[model samples]
Target: MMQVIYDPLLPWAAIWASAAGVVLIVALALWRRLPGWWLRGLAGAALLAALANPSLQDEAQTPLSDIVVLVVDESASQTLSDRAVQTARAIDEMERAIAGLENTELRVVSLGDAPGDEGTLLMTALSEAVAEEPRGRLAGAVLLTDGRLHDVDRAPDLPAPLHVLLTGHEDDWDRRLVVENAPAFAILDEEVTLTLRIEDQGQAPAGDGLVELDVAVDGGAVRQVRVPVGEDLTLPLTLTHGGTNVIQFTTPAAEGELTDRNNTAVVQINGVRDRLSVLLVSGEPHPGERTWRNLLKSDSSVDLVHFTILRPPEKQDGVPVSELSLIAFPTRELFLDKIDEFDLIIFDRYKRRGILPAIYFDNIRRYVEDGGAVLIAAGPDFASADSIYRTPLGQILPAAPTGRVIERGYLPELAPLGERHPVTAGLPDLAPPGAEGAPGWGRWFRQIDLDPRAGQVVMQGVGDRPLLVLDRVGEGRVALLGSDQAWLWSRGFEGGGPQLELLRRLAHWMMKEPELDEEALTATAEGQRMTVTRRTLADEVGELEITGPDGNVTTAPLQEVAPGRFQAEVTGPEIGLYRLSEGDQSAVIALGPAAPREFEETVASGAALEPVVARGRGGIVRLEDGVPSVRQVREGRPAAGRGWIGVTPRHAYVTSDVTVTPLVPAWLFLVLAAGLSLGAWMREGRR
Candidate 1:
């Protein structure tokens, strides 16, 4: 290329002044009718031209290839139906067409699913690709995707047009289950409402508009219900336990649906107890009686109804009953009428004294069998003939008193099984075992001798006898503390142990808190990494069987982290639900959102990218129709047509070399001006 440029021999101010003087002289000569006035003006003009030197510049140019960004979506949704095949074909065609163009290049960027539950980030990938190339050389951008991008708000400002080659059929359709609203925590045994809906997108076929929905809790049996589609369904659920409750809802996959990934959804709601109601019945007043009262009363959420047998019917102090200020115990109302309302019933050193009849004891046994918890904190009375074991409640008692009491100072020790039991697993850490110089926890001065009957012995006293036993009776639970000196620890006798913690775990475990279960499987997730935990009383566990979101099954070995706890960490996990099982224990956990953004809508559509494409003056074409021909178009013109897509030709180049040459020599211009001035002078002299 060649262009004329100025390289002034003198300052611009001097050049302009010389030109102005020449113009004024020419005008004066013309007005006075002077001879050869035009010749004198021409000579003056030549001298001014020499001062303003002009040069021609020639440039050697190299054409730079125009960059066309091709972002191919390989996200989860893009694999539905024939969209993957369509994307592959469109990319091949685009590469060839861009290559055939004279000075154009294709920059292919393959995009996958975003981390966590963040679906497809097509716009983010495109923006990054565009930034890698020079804006002046960017001709246009093309996307081969299903158009279900999740990050549309991050679209970049492109210097060229944007085109979309949608990759689904016109008749594509999908049915998805959507959970509109669900609470993260709900009160146990109380009805909580959840809002859900089933939607059909694209060209849905005609049907009865009713689908069967399957609902399950904690991986139990599933219940099916028929509900109408496209309408929100309010489901009322009551949690059974006080911990995480996994509720799964699924609908059968329909025929001709794009994908079934969205047919199932999971919701985890933690169950919490509104309040704890405990019934405390003390046979006689003792030092440990106040300990039970203080422990139960300390928690504001616990409602305690304590009744101590201060005056028995057999005791006659020869004083008038009316003179004694004591409220009579309501045995009938408490043990028969409203026993089910109380969550736990504690018998502290209680013995049969004709107060509660045999019928009341039988009713108490029935209550324990029907999912009610009972704890027996025995004293010397339990080893005597008046022991409650001789009553109907004895059937549910885990141990039988041997009619002996040991009154020697002894430090309680955890049994082997107690080290693995959740109730007593970590109690040893509170006060370490005694050494030669140091005594561990406070010593108990008395222990009731007992023979283990059915339950597991969790603690031992002097002579390796059962000090504490826990058992399961029917659907309920029972605990036996064979000593009444637990309060010694509360007094900080010697060195106190975990007195409060031990009682708290015992209570929660009897109430069937899921976290306190002896055998459990659970999982937690952070991004794509998952930690699987197995808690059991067994010495060891086998490898865990893990079923991923895509129905692929794999095995992971567990390593012992604690006495009874095992764990395994899984990396690079997919976003969705995972089912883990080892032996009879199974657990379901979600690594990301229950309904990932990718599968929320499976049918392909270009509505999300339409506005962006319009702003760039581009068009949306379906790959179902043949791959469009790539053509070169001018900027600010239509960049797409019925059977073809257009890219703007930037024609950008680089100037490798430049040469500058003066238009005329300064010496030649000076000589020409002198000759003209002399000619004009002679003419004037002759006149």
Candidate 2:
């Protein structure tokens, strides 16, 4: 390139002032009718031009190649139907076409799924790619995608046009199940409403408008229901147990749908109990009776109904009934009518008194068998002739008292099975028996000798006798503590044991908390990585089987982390629900959102990028029609057409070298001025 430039020898203000003075002098001579005015003016102009030196510049230039960004969408949705193949073909054709164009290069940018379920960030990728190249050199951007981008707001201001090569057929359709609304927590045994909708996108086929929806909880039995499509359905669900409840809703894949990945949705609603209702019946007052009272009363969520049998019916102690401070026990209200209302019933040192009728005892037994919990803190009364074992309640008791009470200080130690039981496992950080033949916890002064009939012995006393036995009766649970001296631990006797922690676990376990289940399968996820855990009382667990979102099955060997806890980590390549099973235990956990943003809508369209493309005077062409030819066009003209897409030729260049030559030598201007001035003086003298 060549251009004329200036190098001023004086300030602009001084040059302008000197030119004004010369013009005034010429005007005065002209007014006076002098013959040398024009000559004098010419001399003055020559001298001023010398001060303002002008030069001709020529630049050595190199043309830079135009950068055409080929943003390829490799997100999860792009893999649906024939989109992947179409994308591949479009990329190949574009690469070849850009290579054919003179001084044009294709910059292929492969865009994958965004992290944390943000879906396909095609705009984000395009913006970044454009930022890496010079704005002046960017020919245009071509995106080969399904066009289901999630981050359209992040679109960058492009100096060049943007074209989209959409990659799906016009008739492509998809059916997806969407959970519009769901609660993160629901009250146990109460109904919670969930809003759901079924949507069909693209050219969907005609149907009955009713789809079969399958609903399952905790990966259990699936219940199917037919519901209308395109309308929100309110599902009323009641959580039966406490802890995390994984509810899965699935609609079977249609015949012509693009993919079945979105046919299922999972919702995790934590089940929480409103309150715990405990009935504490003390046959006689003892030091441990207050211990049970304090434990139950301390929990703000527990409603404790306690009654101490201070005066039995058989005792006629000459005391007036009105003068007595104790109120009569409501046997009919507690044991007969409202037995099912209480979550747990504790018989603390209770004997078979005539107070509760035989029918009442039978009702209590029935309560235990019908999803109710019972705990027996045995005293000497448990082994006496008046023992409750002789009553109808004895049928559900796991152990039978042997009519023997051993009175000796002995450490209450965990049995081998206790090391695996969730209630006793890793309790209070107590060490195992060492060379001193004693555990780290305190000791109890008395233990009732009992013959084990059923259930697992979790704790043992002197002579390896059963101190604590836990068993399940039908849907309910029962636990027996062979000694009432747990209060000794509460009093910090001989370095007290984990009295509070142990009782908490025992209570929660008997109440059927999911975390305290004897055998369970659970999983947690961080990004695409998953950790599967299996808790069982067995000596060893088998390999864990994992079912991924894509219905791919794989197995991972479980490593024993603790006595009965086994764990294994697996990578889930896709973001969706993962089902894990080990033996009979099964768990369903979502690696990300149950219905990921990618599969939320799988049909291909250019709506998201339409506004952006139009703003740049570009067009969208479907790959199904055919890959368009690439051509060069003017910057502001339309960059896409029916059969071709155009890239603007920037013709941008870099100046490698510069050369400047003065238009005229300064000495020439000086010589011309001197000659003009001499001529003007001779002409004036002659006049």
Candidate 3:
């Protein structure tokens, strides 16, 4: 680096000159009275002033051109109509205009759309551009976009002036349909409220204008609701389905409408559940029958239908059918048809009787095979001659009565699997408040002893005999409870049990839902992460294979989270659907939304940023034209007119050489000092 130095004492020479002259005149007037200190002070001031020298130094320097930054907006709004076309035109013209200027260069930046509700972040782009270039070189900036900047407060401490180029037409206008407020979920058959707003921008004035709003569900128009201009309306909507229901509200496209992007809004309302249908059949009503009713009735979602065979065919009464006040059972309707409608089917203390013929028993077997669920609470009849084991269901049922019965009260205990099963798991203890000393639940006097087969043995009663056995037969599932003592769980004879939870899981498992399955594989994804789970007989899976969005394959080992289950997780590099597999089973899942709303809006327009372009002394142009030429103009010069605008440059450098000097030289100072002193002396001599 070049260096320079100078003295700060050049102006003091005049002081000493006056002091010396005073001394000479005073000495001549009062030669004997002159003070020695005054002479010494005067000499010191003059000598010190001459000792400190000031000089000029110079060095060679290479000139640098000024730098100018051109920030062009590329946000989502710019993709509308001819906005993108106009932006391209303006940039070309600006480039040509800036190229022609002397001692100037240009830096161009393009900003695209942001995710979510992010609008134009112009200030962030400008800050980034300024940081990349040398600050000293920055002459100023030219912003080519609409003035609607999302981050307006991020303006920098600029060393140069900033200009804006607006990109919109004078009469640009648009109409948009907005869904103001929507609920995430709504009850079935109940009205849900939704708020909406219809907005018109630019020259679209509010008058007697009527916006025809056509509300639709699943692509069908429900109604054409008329709304006033710039008005907010609240509409009540009712949902029919029980799952995700998509409701679309749109306004009729008016003549000469700017674009249809804002004309339609989609709102999804998930269906709510408040009730469940349950069918309960009893061999005969007993003292504990009320226990089942109370347990089911406690839930708002349960719609229980209870039926009892008061007297079997073995009981003959001397009464005519018309006078007997009893109707023949609709066995075919219950077992053959509409069996799938029931979420749970319970047979309490039930057994084979003449009331239901062999044909109905056969139909019941088919019901289970068709994915229907069945829960059997066996009494003494289960070990007696009236047992239903001899029916066609014998082939799929997981338990067989041993023709033996226990008659003593015993505590109920969960099997190893029952602790994790949703049905039997987490049952409440029967012990009441302040009664912690008592057993949890009531017990039954009798329980049938049954032999376990291929199904899972989840619970045991007296003597460790199988009390509850669950098994899947084809697509259906069956849960056999060897005792009719479930009332004991509610009665708190032993300790309270999870009567409700056990029954719920047993009921749903038979419905073939993947979530309730004991041995199954399922995969779920969010974003690019995928979770692979294996519900198997073993604690850990050997390995899992995954196919990514990019067609890459990877295998992962899984850890056991619980009994008879294994799971693994991996994140893919892409955003889309994915598939996971283990051995013969596979599952497909999605990470992100089916369609990303941000990237889907792909139209290019100029209305969003036209004003920014115009502010930079640049005009809009269409991309149809060939490559435009570059030109340079002076600062504050009109670079863009009908077809183009100019670019500016602010000289920047890593400073190479520097020189500094005083205006006057030491020799000139001394000569001028001597000349004046000589002139004073000559005047004295002439006098």
* lDDT of each residue in 1-687, candidate 1, tens digit only: 999999888999998988889999999999999988999998998898788888899999999999899999999888888887888888889999999998899999998888777789999999899988999999999999888998899999988899999999999999999999999999998999999999999999999999999999977899999999999999999998877788999999999999878898899999999999999999888889999999999988889999998877888889877776377788888999999999999999999999999999999899999999999999999999999999999999999999999999988889889989998898878884562213267788999999999988888889778999999999899999999999988887877778888998998888788889999998887887889999999999999999887789999999999999999998636767788999889998887766688889878899999999999899999999989999999999999999999999999999999999988998888999999999999999999
Kindly list the per-residue Cα lDDT of model 2 for residues 1-687, writing each as its tens digit: 999998989998898999999999999999999899999999999989998898999999999999999999998888788888898888889989999999999999998888888888888899889989999899899888988988899999888889999988899999988899999999999999999999999999998899999999987898999999999999999999787798999999898899888888889999999999999999888999988898888999899999988777777989987676467788899988999999999999999888998899999899989899999999999999999999998999999999999999998888999989999999737533432335677788999999999999999999889999999998899999999999987787767878878888888888888999989998887888988889999999899998887789999999999988999999887777888999999988987777788888888889888999998898899888899999999978888888998999999999999999999999999999999999999999997
Structural similarity to truth (TM-score) of each candidate: 0.95, 0.96, 0.59
Q: Which predicted model would earn the best TM-score? A: 2
lDDT (10s digit) by residue, model 3, range 76-154: 5666667677788878776766666777777999887554345577878999999998777776677776555666667
- lDDT (CA) for every model shown? 0.90, 0.90, 0.66
TM-score of 1: 0.95
Q: Stretches of candidate 1 above 4 Å error? A: 9-44, 318-326, 432-439, 673-687
Cα RMSD of all models vs. native, in order, equals: 2.3, 2.2, 10.5
Comparing 2 and 3 on TM-score, the stronger one:
2
